[model samples]
Target: MPKSVWFLIIGMLVNTTGNSFLWPLNAIYMHDYLGKTLAMAGFVLMLNSAAGVLGNLLGGFLFDKIGGYKAIMLGIFLTVVSLIGLTQWHEWPHYVWLLTLLGFSGGIVFPSMFALAGTAWPEGGRKAFNAIYLAQNVGVAVGPALAGIVAEKGFDNVFEVNLWMYVLFFFIALLTFKRFETDSVVPKNVVSERKRITNKASLYALLIISSSSVLCWIAYSQWSATISSYTQDLGLSLKQYSLLWTINGLLIVAAQPLIAPLVKRWENNLKRQLVFGVVIIAISFGIVAFASDFKMFAAAMVVLTFGEMFYTPALPTIANQLAPKGRQGFYQGILNSATTVGRMIGPLFGGIMVDQFGMMALMSILVIIVVIAVIPCLVYDRPLVKRSKSTTVLE
Candidate 1:
């Protein structure tokens, strides 16, 4: 493996290990352990998600202006501080502020990571990125599975582990910073012709698709937010819930590497894959609404994982394909922002509908949103190709 790839993997592992507990249990801790209501928990997540969206946008701007390693190191430090706060503190107002900080800081890490990967191998950024993607899924799979096992001992145990995870990430990041500085890898201006294309029409169409795609993720994100509670209401244990997360992670690991060749085969036409992802996610969540048995829920998750496999890799691929030269980081940041949008709004949307009308109603609404998101793929088909020797940006 290349040194750069190792850097990405180690960074991802540390980041995700902290994220494992933070994401799955954050809301649960607020609502169940800390005595906040479900709506209140959703609201806190909403605030965090909103912060994340802004962070993605600003992080992109920072990456574009300042550079990669500096921005990412700052993000890692902030995240570490946030984790420490969450582990030690328990008050409502303080936790809310910490959650906001965590979301904001965590937001910076992703776009910077993607931008750095894109810059490091200007020629094969996407393929090299596939490795980073795989590493992330591995971390995702491990974090929740481990969290589940520890949560069986108690929620505090989970939080304690997360604190250590952040400490691990902090030191690893320090090492990563030194490694990047000493390494030969640096951003190269390989693209001789610099073009700047800002198609408002296309950008609008993309955001519409992005919003809808985000809604599907919102639907998927519910499995962690409310679905676990729903399963517990149905009498499942933490171990069983962990099994579900384990299945989701394994699917991502097994599926992501396979996605690279297919994406390559599809080349710049990754929008079609994005459409397929939305469709699959919609179907899975729709089924989950009716699931009464463990097997049925497992089947729904399998379908959901298929959608994830298609969508997660394709989002960045499409962004890169559409992005102007020298601005891939900005658009990738935008792509990260879309996920934050979905996460921020998803909890509120899912919580309300599920609280009022139940899971079926929530799933129905997500299906419509996803269908609406797919419409743009029909008309927005041009790949932002580099104009060999020209320096002008065009449609």
Candidate 2:
């Protein structure tokens, strides 16, 4: 692996380790530990997602102005502050506000990292992305699993570890960034040509892709929302739910890298890869809708894993490719924004459906969303094929 690859891997690992603890237990922690109601917890999460939108814009603008290095450092600093505040806070609103800061900080760093990685290699962005994803998955896998154990001890233990991880990331980033570029920003003088894709085409694709991305989040978000309820419906414990997340993470780690190369080989087109992923994800949701027993649920999870293996890596890779010069960060930010949008909506939708109509209803709605996401993808083949020529940068 190249140095850039190592950087992304390490960065993602550290960042994701922090994410693992928060994501699995964030809402639960708010509701149970802080004595907030479920509605309050959801509201807090919504605030974070909303703040993340601004963070994405801030990150992109900073990347374009000061440079990716500076933007990332700022992100790390903010994250450290947020984590520390979160660790110390006991009041409901206090924790919620701190978590909002954490989300915003993460948004800043996440897209900035992608922008930097895109620029860093000038080549191997795709594979580097795969490595980053792999490392991220590994961290995610370990974080939640470790947090599950730590939750038994106390949420404070996990929060404390998270603070340490962010602190370590901050210093490591400072050290590693010395040799990286911040001197010459992407020049604004280059002649910008919108590719053959019309504005309408691009917008349509964006909406479709965003919708599907939202569906993806909905499916994934179920782990926190309906899936846990379904598990308890079958008489499982929170530990068992955590185990399910562990299994999901492990599958992502084991399957993604193994299939990434093959997927790249077979379908180098980013749009196609995304479409493929959506189709698979739709199928997975269908499986979940019908599944009742633990074995059936496990099978559905396997399908969901396959869908993730295709989709998660493809989205960012495509965003980097589709992004105009000097605006890689902006496009990546938009992609992340789509994800934040999904996070905001997916849980709310899932919760409503689960409460009102149960798991099958939730799955059914997601399936329709996924299907809607597929049409524009199929129609946009020409642009994707043209964009496919840029593969050398990432190959």
Candidate 3:
């Protein structure tokens, strides 16, 4: 990998580390410490995710128009400011407002980071995305372990730790990415009409793929929202809950070496890989429905982590492949938006279901939704597959 790519990875590590401290605790803190109901906690999270959707779109546009450096810095600045305010005033409405702003700011950073990674190592293929994904898990691994300890002291300590991480992240970005430049303006007439049509077809496929991704995230996000609260209701400690995430992150990092070969083997069959992974994810949730102890929850998490490892890296790689020249950021932004949309809806939906119908009902419904998502995943690339077959015949 290039120096620039490594820098991006390091930046992601710090950035995600800061973020992981807060997000995994958001639902629990709101419900337990702040005296909010699970349903209300979910609503706050939904608002946060909605803000993220806007930020994803805006960041992508700015990355295309201004460049990654400026766009990322802008995001970091906003996020840091929000974090500072959160440290001081984390009461009810104030906490909600700061968290929403944090979501927007953080959202801007993610799409830009992914876009920069794609540009940094265009020839690196899945390796580029895998690196970023790995860095994220590394953050997850470190952040939650430390957060678990800090939360033992107080939730205020958790917020302070997160604030410092972002401050470090901002400095890293300032020093390392100041000269970063990847944006390019493609000439309108450079491509013939036929190639333009091809680009459009590719984009359509990407959108379909993105839709499937959204559904997958909706099911997956229950871990942080309803499932987190559900565990506490089952008499699990906060330390145990945090430990689950630590286990998830450690498993991803530890298993990546073994998983990479399989990923390469199926590199040409991303759709098949997605379907297989989604099945595992759906099954994991079914297992969760039966879980009555921390051990069973941990078992479900291990399965869910495997599924995530398989599919998560592929999403960005596919987006990078489908992106037209000068629009990598925009396409990545769309992909981020899809994931954010799922996240935005997931908490609220899960909260409502659990509140009204109960945990078993929510789990059953999620499994069904995930299974249905496989349809779009399987069919989204029909156009591209057809084009490939036709080209092969012509040859």
Q: Per-residue lDDT tens digits of candidate 2, residues 232-266?
A: 66766556567666777789877756775768675
Which is superior by lDDT, 2 or 3? 3
* TM-score between candidate 1 and the true structure: 0.87
Candidate 1 structure lDDT: 0.72
What RMSD does each model have against the real structure?
Answer: 4.0, 4.4, 2.2
Q: Rank the candidates by lDDT, best first.
A: 3, 2, 1
Q: Quote each prediction's TM-score.
A: 0.87, 0.87, 0.95
Least well predicted 10-residue stretch by lDDT in candidate 1: 382-391
Give lDDT: candidate 2, residue 194: 41
Candidate lDDT (C-alpha), each: 0.72, 0.72, 0.89
Candidate 1 residues lying further than 4 Å off, grouped into runs, are 177-209, 256-264, 382-395
**Candidate 3 segments whose C-alpha is farther than 4 A from its true place:** 185-192, 385-395
How well is each residue in 19-46 modelled by candidate 3, as lDDT tens digits? Answer: 9998988999999999998889999999
The Cα RMSD of model 3 versus the native structure comes to 2.2
Best by TM-score: 3
